[model samples]
Target: MGSDALSPEVAARERTLDDLRRRMASVPGRGESATGHIPREQPLRRDLLPVPGPLAELLPDGGLPKGAVVAYSGAHSMLSGLLAAVTGDGGHAAVVGLPRLGLLAAAEMGAQLSRLAVIADPGPDPAEVAAVLLDGLDLVVLGLGDLAVPPARCRVLAARARNRGATLVVAGGTWTNPSLRLDTRVTGYRGLGAGRGRLRSVCLDVRVSAKAGPPRHGRIDLCAQAGRTEWLAREAETREVVDLREAVS
Candidate 1:
């Protein structure tokens, strides 16, 4: 009875994947979907230049959303670098009001000069910059500081991106309107050297909270080189669904 509820959607996705497998089966480095394994198609081509960051490669889609705002933490430099790489590839990207961001470091990660715009103005208005950035670019990167705007505007940007197939990466706080909210956790870190060494490297654990579909969560491992990102699937773990309406007591 429980499996019956999921038959239609699961069957449809399976059929689609089976068809895709048949077409791409001859391709190298690609493997077949094992028994009981759910097939999920990666959004972007995995071969495009990898971004600089340890966790960029581990993301399920191989990168961030091409048209949705993803709120994140300021502590993870690797995460920010990954976002910049996504925006700076083949399209113009705007980094708004993130004064603390090291543009040089981002560039070192993989941000392209011709496709990057860094807006350092610390103004009270977010809509102004958001409007301009949204209109003239394929991607928008904003640092959500202590802003006083309503969530509706964020929703509007999300809707626009979804409609236009553009991607937005929002850092520094919780974005309620995201199609997927990515929460990162550090699994392990390496050492470059002593005293002057950088964050040797780190792994990322992701918890994706979605607005509609079933919330997906998992962990991934990644390593950052001078300007390349490598992602590896660690373990695809299932999450427990708690009913919000149910009483805790």
Candidate 2:
């Protein structure tokens, strides 16, 4: 049963799988026991993956649920935050089909780039690549682009993630019945003075919807200053207005 005796197509598939395993093994903090082979009855706390500070407060599970599919919409900053949170917490992650993803922003957000694998162009079927990555990575972010994945395929990918004890995050296109959904919108920007001052922060209105229960909503602020990105609490609606004449006096 040597590989030399197998057909060309079979050999190629085997080689591809081997390469994937090698790459997965090379990721930092990927020990033998952490390669999605833990027993279901184990007492390990693998139920959820860590999310950013503000986002964790919004989720019912306090983090992204393992073995589930989550659909995200709106700003790409949210996706960067997810990647930064997961990878920064010593978990391996993969990004597929997000060619324009800002790695610098993720780094500023505290992501460990060494533990992240980015597949900017995942061939014709990015879903297939994501499915494969779920076998090893703790989180897989799949950019659907313009492809409308069929319901059956979506179900299959979700099942694969569940069986592998990984999380799949889908962006763009349409996903059928995701376990959770996050929608974010930029409400406003801070540090502007009559369109003359540099931007200092962004305000995001985030909504979290689950398969059951009422949806939760929150506002978050992303402050970029001093070469770091900080997630701050929601700003208050009421603020003290200072008159220009009084301030000048």
Candidate 3:
């Protein structure tokens, strides 16, 4: 197999192999092989994003995992809070097909307005929009509105999220095989007494359940002031009950 005696085809194959090795060696990493496909740690190194104070306790790591597929119903404010939590960290968030989603409310709750995108009323279909957003954003909230999204569509979006390492949050519709399921309702209100008082806190009955765990219910009081939001703890027994009633005029 001397080079001088090698056939033309054999010599060409050798040249191609050498070129491939050279290219692989030029790539960065701590691997031994020339093209050691690099360790899985590179992508997994992205740390999980922290959730809002009120909902942090509900998640397993007290933070949202990348590539998570979540389905939520009930209180719209809760959905907005989750968006703010992700967008607060400089991560981009896309709200697809939600014509009535309150952008100002999310802004007041800590979301960076610059990182938020609203694709309201996304034509007759939003699956394409969601897919495209998933490729570029860290968080994509797909609003199915009153229409029931098909299982196939959910699976497709879920696959896309997994491939892109983006969190997929579904609202106004149901989904199958969701990594997390959230049910929230406005059970009461706080920081107001009469119909003329200023609005303060909103009491939410949040039920959180994951694919591997049982459902858990808890009460959370969220207060927004001066365009900022925080979780409000209940008063002690000795203190007078500051009734959390809604302010209406």
Candidate 4:
């Protein structure tokens, strides 16, 4: 629905209500009402907003699978903290060789600053950073950059995560390293016309496949600037479906 459909007064009122609901959801230590009869105020946990329909069913936790690697290309900035969000609250995470990301933005995305560690400015070989990641973290985020890491290293990293129950996220660089993979691409929808204000949105198309699990695929609309990441059912035609042949082999 267009924002113009409602009168300015109504729109203002709706926005106020939205803000109040969001604030109430954010209150700390505010559990169910003292009587214990009130329905729990939105299950208390720090999960990612929600998963897209098709992919959600495939995940055991209705989110990204724990202790597995999910990859993204050209949209790292857009889908930051994917691992941490999927890992839930109080989860530990590490970022390797991510030289360009804004640390504050990282914090905003969900990785706790106290729980996060960074391996900055590493050499071209990603294996070096991968080794530290495999040994240290419960969840690891890595940027490929110029590194041409061997396929064997990716396999080993995935195995270590599986063995230790960690989640590995790869973004903005090389892919094609493991038995399972998730490839993502972002498409931006532009707002049109002169009378209406410009409204923009990004759709993240995800293709996820695992050796034993079903080859699942879907697209989720994500709000980048807004703190909330909600699932969008209807949208423009910019989303794309990726073929898994290359990733599976």
Candidate 5:
């Protein structure tokens, strides 16, 4: 059937895909070689996207690797921080199937809302929507919910992200063989004491495991105040002094 005869929703999806393609075409040197082929080995900068400073320390490359699929599990704030960092760095990003994502929090974290796209409902097949977005966006975040995507489909999406020089982040699903996996949890909170002060910051414990290396762990503080957000690294543990004389006596 012709596009003109399609339903309004379908036509709108088609239009969005077309617009993404056009935008990608206008950009230059997205890991493309002189022969118009995407090179496997992109330069250092082009091979990765900027991430928040605290999160960067957990990754091997100090950034989110381009052309790779990463699985994130844990606090949703981590994802928000990622969106903020990527968009704030002048890169385009899209979130699929996450209607509750706090764009206001992302903005406070320094995200460029104009460069970010949110597809609250991707009409059942969110992976497909994410694939189309990968063609143009610098980062594509897909929320998988309880659906267990087949390994084959995941591979295809990974390859597409690689060819397009985009990063794919899968959240809340069973995706096999991602390049990296990050697990995070809330460790503590700060700025509230004596039942009087307002909440200001949260501490998260982040665990990063990649394909080739041992897992790395770190703590980070997500601070929001005065219409701005900041990610700050925290010491993994605090030291306490011990006196041996008391025990021995």
Candidate 6:
């Protein structure tokens, strides 16, 4: 029977049932309905950003912790590889003031160009530009480029990121108090010989030192070969990475 034709008491009961159903559907993580999902606004816990399996160990939390600032110095290829996990999985990423950024290489590393933005140069006040992007971007990659960011400004950005659950990654430089710092050095290059072949891959020796965690060191591979595999793998097959991490720690 139509709701208009029902008795008042029966109609009230039906309305209550409908209201209960709506409340149940809106309960986050319970289940989704056809209309749309009602997200949890006040969850006690938050989740980290997705990271590639091989690079997961680099982060203390096994994933890129939201609201953390990481500094990547002299690790262009590694930065690109890391960004691929974010941009490829429908996350928005921004690159500012890194004119020499290998965009083609970033794609080869698996980043979805459609979801990435590159400012190349942001004029004199790049930090100000970054502040604006922090409002909406999932990740903001800023190029240091000799511009010195004051301590107070850095703190403000860090606080903002924490509040917004976004990551602030500074590349090609360092900051006053970065949550993590990685120094990358090219230990060797492979798949090339005597000025006769193209560069295929690089072996990087990275020393990971963090302000909030213990220090560790490891080797990571950045390969441009066809069907590239894990970018970070242990040099010794017999020794596990976790064991090496413990040894280094």
TM-score of each: 0.58, 0.81, 0.74, 0.58, 0.81, 0.72
Which tens-of-lDDT digit does each residue in 87-157 have in candidate 6?
A: 76556677877878888878887887866777786666667666666666667888988777889989999
Better of 2 and 6 by TM-score: 2
Off by over 4 Å in 4: 1-61, 77-79, 83-88, 102-106, 172-179, 190-200, 212-214, 224-249
lDDT tens string, model 2, 188-223? Answer: 776664544666777788999998899999988888
Could you tell me the lDDT of residue 139 within candidate 5? 90
The clash count for each model shown is 6, 0, 2, 0, 0, 0
Candidate 4 lDDT over 172-227, as tens digits, reads 56555554466666544423233434434445666666767677666665444565
**Highest lDDT model number:** 2
Model 1 poorest ten-residue lDDT run: 240-249
How good is model 1 by TM-score? Answer: 0.58
Residue 191 of candidate 2: its Cα lDDT? 60
Candidate 6, after superposition: displacement of residue 14 in Å? Answer: 55
**Per-residue accuracy of model 3 over 1-249 as CA lDDT, tens digit each:** 665797776656456445534543443332112244432233223646546775777676676677888888888787788788766655667788887878888878887776677777665556666777676677888888777778898788888888877888888766778888888888666556645366677777788888786787767877877767776543434232244442342
Tell me model 4's lDDT, rounded to 2 decimals: 0.53
lDDT of 1 by residue, 1-249 (tens): 785576775666455445433533332221112232323443456333224333444444555555566666534555456645554444445677787777666665566654566666625554445555555455666776765446877777777766655566677644665655666765554443345355534545566665666556555544467666455556436222222232121
lDDT of 2 at 136: 81
Q: Which ten residues in a row have the lowest lDDT in candidate 3?
A: 25-34
lDDT of 3: 0.69
